[model samples]
Target: MWTAVLLACVGCYLLKLAGMSVPARVLDHPLVERVADLIPVALLAALVAVQVFAAGPGLTVDARAAGLAFAFVALLLRAPFLVVVIGAAAVAAGLRLL
Candidate 1:
């Protein structure tokens, strides 16, 4: 276990070093720029999907799904971030209580 942990740490350090060694021109390319800009959004969406739908080894659609749906509608209506989060939490909590 310690060996695996040390290897993973070394791998991560090498990956960071590789990223740092990338040339400026390569990083400045339009395609790279576009992908870099969208990576965070894509990752966040994936995380949300997993969190909302995954339950252990299977999938689920429960109060969490309803909360996500409510949040989506709130976003469409231009609700503030705090309002959206609070509204979603309230929805999931309310549903779970029933």
Candidate 2:
């Protein structure tokens, strides 16, 4: 177990070192800039999808889906951030209570 952990740590350190060694010109390319800008949004969407829809070895469509849907509609209507979040939570909670 310790050996595995040590190897993982070394691997992670080398990966970081490789990223840091990338040339600035390569990093500064327009395509690289665009991809980097969108990566976080893509990751966050995937995270939300997994959290809302995944259920153990299957899929789910329940209170969390309701909450996400509510949030989406709220966003479309230009709702305030706090309102959108609170509204989604309230919606999910309300459905769960049913």
Best by TM-score: 1
Model 1 lDDT vs. the true structure?
A: 1.00
TM-score of 2: 0.94
What is the C-alpha RMSD, rounded to one decimal, of candidate 1?
0.5
What is the number of residue pairs that collide in model 2?
0
Candidate 2 residues lying further than 4 Å off, grouped into runs, are none
lDDT of 1 by residue, 49-95 (tens): 99999999999999999999999999999999999999999999999
Which candidate ranks first by lDDT, i.e. highest? 1
Could you give candidate 2's per-residue lDDT for residues 1-98 as a string of tens digits? Answer: 99999999999999999999999999999999999999999999999999999999899899999999999999999999999999999999999999
Candidate 1, position 67, lDDT: 99
Candidate 1 error regions (>4 Å): none
Q: Alpha carbon lDDT of residue 60, candidate 2?
A: 86
